[model samples]
Target: MTAVEKLLGETARADAQRNVRRLVAAAREAVAEVGVDVTAHEIARRAGVGIGTFYRRLPSREALLQAVVEDTVYEIVELAREALRDPDPWHGFCTFAAEFVQLRAMSCGINEALGTDCALSLDAPLEQLREQIRLLVERCQQSGAMRDDVPWQDVPFVLTSVMTGDRTIGLTAADDQWRRNLRVVLAGLRAQQLHTSE
Candidate 1:
């Protein structure tokens, strides 16, 4: 007999695996809707599973939060890669950056996820994304489409402002406000280049 069979019957192991997937999906909804402070009981209820099963799978709130972090990080990294494939460097950069604000209304923002109870640990993938941004920014600068004054590190702050604005300051009310704000920032990035050319 296998270790799982020794610990749990074969049917019980399969059920446990199903419960784990259910808990993960439920936790995503709960956290996205109510932030990371969502209770384990509520998550179990959403999953249509028992509290015991939920704890058996995730064990604690922090565990759920860590799972959410992992899922979201993987998703956004792929989105960034997709953006990087665009022909225009500026378009690619903005597209990836824009996702920060665009997706917040539907899911948890970066600050929220990072600030969650799980001690969110994202080192490798985040570094890759930062390097991706740096490469795109360099390409844009070389194309004469972006200002040399701005640094790649500064892009996150701009995105942070967009995310912050969307959450606290009612940017979603105007519908076009985010686009306008992004346009203004992009314009500023190119303003110096245009003046020099003229």
Candidate 2:
């Protein structure tokens, strides 16, 4: 191949990479706005790319959703790690839980992608997230900040309860009612008896 041909080939590959990044970013926004059922055309339009380019990069709607899901999960995992580093286990756990639910509520696409069976294999990252959550729960329980009756397995359910999604009856996304619900859940999760220093 001529040097010019090689240079052109490298440039094409670079452009493709950039397009993929743009598509993923745009898909995130589109999913947040339109849920998991967002159309490819809309995502492409948001990305400022042609439909053909979006197809060449993501291949299908599921591919785009998976890309967004992967990005969100990685973000969740990082947040969990940061939470684990906090000095107060109960505060860290509460803050993490609130933030986690809020993040999930922002993207119905993520909930759908996670709950449904897709081609994505995220066992390692998922397991890491689970382990971190377990540690946080255990720490809180040991410190008497959390109720012993509430198992680690129940924590996911507690957090997901606030993710009512667009189906919230008589409540809109702008209501900020989920924050109130989270506060209640956190209060219930805490130990009922007060700890006093004698």
Instruction: Name the top lDDT candidate.
Output: 2
**RMSD per model, one decimal:** 5.7, 6.1
Report the poorest 10 consecutive residues by lDDT, candidate 2: 2-11
Task: Assess the local accuracy of residue 7 in candidate 2 as a C-alpha lDDT between 0 and 100.
Answer: 24
**Number of clashing residue pairs in every model?**
0, 0
Which has the greatest TM-score? 2
**Residue by residue across 1-198, what tens digits does model 1's lDDT show?**
322222233225677877776777777788778776688889899999888877665546675666565657666777777776888877887787778556554565345764344455667556766777778788878877777878878866676554334344542546556666767776677647576777
Candidate 2 stretches greater than 4 Å from native: 1-14, 58-61, 115-120, 165-174, 195-198
lDDT of 2: 0.75
Error of 1 at 181 (Å): 2.2
Q: Look at candidate 1 and tell me the lDDT of residue 107.
A: 66
What is the C-alpha lDDT profile of model 2 across 57-160, one tens digit per residue?
65577766755666677778788878888999888998899878888777666665555664665566577778888988999999898899998989988888
